[model samples]
Target chain A: MKIENIKKEFPIFNNKVQNNDLVYLDSANSSQKPLVVVDRIYDFYTKEFSNVGRSVHYLAVAATNLYENTRSAVQKYINAKHKNEIVFTKGATEAINLVANTFGQKYLKEGDEILLTELEHHSNYVPWHYLRKNKGIKINFAEIDEHGDISLEDIEKQITNRTKIIAITHLSNVTGAILPIKEITELAHSKGIPVLVDGCQSAPHMKMNMQDLDCDFYAISCHKMYGPTGLGVLYAKKKWLDDLPPYQGGGGMINEVKKDDISFGELPNKFEAGTMATAQVIAFNESINFLNKIGVENLVKHENDLLNYGEELLRKNNSVKLIGNPRKKGAVLSFTIDGIHPHDIATILDEDGVAIRAGHHCCQILHDKLGLTASARASLGVYNSKDDLDKLNESINNCKKIFNK
Target chain B: MNLKELYQEIILDHGKNPRNLGKFDNFNKDAKGHNPLCGDKVHLFLKLDENKKVNDISFEGEGCAISMASASIMTDLMKGKSEKDAKEIIEKFLDMIKEKDDIDTKLLEEDEKTKLMSLGGVKNYPMRVKCATLSWHALSSALEDFQKEVTTE
Candidate 1:
């Protein structure tokens, strides 16, 4: 993929921010919108805007076809066996919550273990905390080595026969470490426990095949993948999705309503409640096309090049401590200067027009494990170039000079 | 983009050679403040003279140069002033961070909001407002504890 041409696709890249060419290095947090995705959404509001699966009017028919059409497109994009197996939730958080509420309510009993790795994001961590507190389900961690690698050894150590489910992230948002999802999933499958892979970080830039991963549930956010915000896809095995109870109860999730005893609609319909983001969902098809046009493999290769270069620079600075040092990581590079706090690094870097994420990246538990409060993170996306990283490198170097040991 | 532009070299010097970095085992009052957001923390020790004047202030923490410099500055500002005026100065600093409308730092007769204009740069970036204010918050918390102990004892 041509990185410069891809930059042209994001108008935000064309405009100056803070009076400088916006060096947006914060894609792991949220991505800038491509012009095609933006225009698709705007055109829907201007031309064909209506509620999907409602009304017999032409606009409604067009909207319904467009909205549901994105489902098959996404199913094919993720390689799920059936379109009905895909449920559209608000975002990855909601997708996880849907499964948590339904599966936690039904399958998890007192003392049932839910396995998670130390590299899991807070979104993956908190919902299970709710389950553990409310349902008496036990939560256990698969150990992360000093380098932030999650091994099958720890998973096996933590998994007793009582282990009911294993929820893991496909990639670590902070360390950029890629989890062994296939091996992890296969391990869980051997014990007959379904695995839920949080693909919020991986689905955007990495190669994601629901079938090949063989995980029962894979959750993703649309905005993370160059689509609009407020939408995510939850891919589940057909039987598991069919067996799980309805998550949210409201309009459009019903087959028939009686005075008493209401029956719910089937599969994906039962999960999505109330009025959906019709235009964004319809616009999401354009995102599917966008991803298809610039293949996921090429996008990964392009981003990995940036990550590879950034890491080399990061390693040269002896004062900088790279958090979650691992054998395998994603495009995210998180570190902290020895004396300067992550907050200071973030502010100074922002002044230089280098927009990188600084904070715990919402993984507080990992920070606690590392014996630090928060670490600065520089995450890459499609449009980032060597120049963008050079800015980060320069700003960080200035910081090191000021706080020289 | 020199360090002196935002951070005076004096701040870095003070951070590198912090005055009150050592422990104060016995003190009139002590309090700890932790910024859960960035994980910066400070344990402040205050020694007051017989006339209710600050004899000295010292601290120990893991923080950025700005925060440590601000803490060192806070100690410098505290020793010469009485407890009452010291409290007022802290309030002024807090108001500066709040960055309320109609704040005039230059007009001394209008009140002591001028001390706050020193942090006007914080207005540019919303995230660092908390980082700038964390030291002030920790100082206020320490003072509040001191006040509570004085009333009871």
Candidate 2:
């Protein structure tokens, strides 16, 4: 696809805010929705809209098909062994919580460890904190290298004989470094520990084949892949799904509701208890199509080029201090100017119609380890280009001039 | 850019070379406030006068320039004000940040509140509201401890 045509897909790209183009650099936070994904949702509500998995009426049947079709699409996208292995969730945050509660607490015990990396987001961190309250589970953190990449050497140190689970992010949202998940999973499996891979940053930019990766669990959000919000995907292994009990219980997830004894339904249905987001799921399927059309591999190469260019540009400027320098990572480049604060840096960039994130970026532990107060981050997406980065470079130089840094 | 253009000349002068950025040699009252969101912290030291006014105010912290500057300005603002007036300024500062022009019309003109209320522009960015208010919150809590001590006697 031509860059211009890809840019045209998003309606927000055309928004004339402050009499300039809105250069969105916060894709790591959430991707901008394309028109097709938006319209599919609009059309679903306009035509075949109804509560799914409920009534056998025309609209309900169509709604059910749309909703179930999404499961089949996600099943193929991740190459899951079965569609039942794919559970719809609110977002990666909620999906991680469900597993930490249902899978972690149920299986883990007192003095048992939940090993994680220092590079992890707080969503993965705080859930284990809850276990300390209820289950007396111990939390252990793996060290991050100076470049902010997690190594097996650090991970190995934290994993004791008593370690039951290892939860990790596939891509560091801060440094954009990709972890060796297959190797990590193999080590975890050798110890008879289940691994949960947070694929929030990886899934949108790269191809995922869970069958090959063989992680026990993988979680992603639809909105991160240019889909609508309020929906996520949790890809669990077939064996794990068969043994683990349901996370939530209500209507639709049960096979038989009796006065005394109620029977639970099959694999995926047991996870989805309430009414599902039929239209949103269908729209989410369209996001998979959106990725498929451009091809995730091609998208990866294009983004890597941007990352290389961005790194080269920042490397020359002595005033800017780059945090992480992982050769293999996503396009999120976090840096801090010598004298200017991240807040002032972000606001100055915003005034020039270039959006960037400031502050600790929900990774306080990483900041503490880096000895940084806070750093500004500019992340790339499929729609980003060299010109967008040029704007960032120009604005950053302007920060030097304005603040005399 | 002239610092006075954005901040009051008084604020700029104080922020450039803060009154007491160093460690307090003979510190008495002390408290700490941490903004976990941005990983910014403010440790305050006070030597209260016999009349309970702030005789010496010093701060130490790791924060963004806005937070550091705000704390610097705040310590300067508290030099001679009574404890009651200082607390009122802190209250009015938060009110002004969260609800700018919508504030009670009469209170905007009040001298003590208006000094820091000039910083209400930081309210536009909701994420940054905490950055601007971190120092004020620390001062509020530190004074909380001071008040507690005064009543305890």
Candidate 3:
């Protein structure tokens, strides 16, 4: 699909929001779904619906094939070495929790440490914190510099002999700072430490290759990638999947359930418990196909243009102070108007059908570090255009006029 | 649906220059309220006298114009009223915010009722109703000596 006509692919843009054309700039919170993803979900339920992987009936067999097909597609999409390495999860939060729980069980003990950064979303940090509280593991944060970017040197400085795992974000949801995950992985591996990347933001906008980044585990949120909600992908190296224990115990993940002895199933099944999100997993294959058709390189260049256009527009506006000055950033544009609260700015902008997020964007630690309780963010996706940024500027000017600034 | 109704002149004035916006040196009851979604916070302080009458009412926090104005107007009308009367006014105000078109309270003067009704404009915006009610909930928690912090989840 061409970038210029991408907005037409999403049915939501055809409808008006509050009597105005929808200028959705909140893709970082969640991307709008295209017609193909929506139709795939409907078609699966109406025609090929089944509980997948259990029954011997024709529909069950077909549904199971459809479900496993998504795993294979995701493996190829992320360039995982083995098809069994991609595990379907409820969402990225659970994916991170799975790694934290199993890794904490097998590798960590008291006085051991997990290194993180200030830019991590709460989903990444809070799960590890459970280990800190229950198992007495410590979490050390590598602070961001004035530019809000976490450099390789910063990660190296925070690394200690006790650092067992390094869990960090591939890209910040708030500051849009793209971390040096490949180099960070190299540094951590040199010290005999494993790396888990929270790829919720990066997987949508960037080209992801598990082999190239060499991170031990990577988590993805499908809904943020224009797929259905309640479906996630966890890309773990075959080594870690083989070494770590299963996260949950249930019917599908069991190989044998003898009275006294029970054994787990194979690579991906051992981690996925209970009935999975069948329809979402099947529908996410369409999401992968959608991304593939657009081409990751084209998506990258289009979003980069939007980000630069948005940044320059907001920078020219007086009293609009942006959150970060990172040299390497993604599609997030967070800022604060000097005298206007972010909530008020959001409320005013909503009148013009300009939707943006006004909060910590689930990175409260980063907000606190920046000495702000909240900020306004305008994020981009493939469907976004320069016209949307122009409308955003006009709406901001209206907000300023209302406040008599 | 109209932005002007939601942000009238009175609300903007009060939000810009809120009255009774400081901590009390001696306070009988206090409660903190927060809207975790928007990161808005309000710390309410009350000084109740021997006869259970409000001696002073003040607040300190940061939020949007609607929230700040609601808090400012709420604090301005709550002072010098007895605890029983305060409860009645709070109920009336909350009722007006929830569904009622207007509040009729014997405790408040005609002009005070008009000031309180200005916040009713928030009824049109479902998401922002919480912004208009967070401070009032905090005030109620403070009055009843609720031991936990108030949150509009």
What number of clashing residue pairs does each candidate have, in the order they appear? 3, 0, 0
> Model 2 in CAPRI terms: which quality?
acceptable
User: Could you arrange the candidates by DockQ from highest to lowest?
Assistant: 3, 1, 2
lDDT by residue (A78-146, candidate 1, tens digit) is: 999899989998899998988888999999989899999888899898988999899999899887788
**Each model's lDDT:** 0.79, 0.81, 0.92
Residue-level lDDT tens digits of model 2 in A191-224: 8999999999899888889989999999998898
Native contacts recovered, in order, as a fraction for each?
0.64, 0.50, 0.57
What does candidate 1's lDDT look like per residue over B85-152, in tens digits? 77777776756556654343332333223333545456555555655666566666666774321110
Each prediction's DockQ against the real complex:
0.51, 0.37, 0.61
Model 3 CA lDDT for position A27: 92
RMSD in angstroms between candidate 2 and the native structure over all alpha carbons:
3.8
| Candidate 2 chain B worst ten-residue window by lDDT | B144-153
- List the pairs of residues colliding in candidate 1: A176-A329, A176-A330, A177-A329
Rank by lDDT (best first)? 3, 2, 1
Which candidate's DockQ is highest?
3
lDDT of 2 at A161: 91
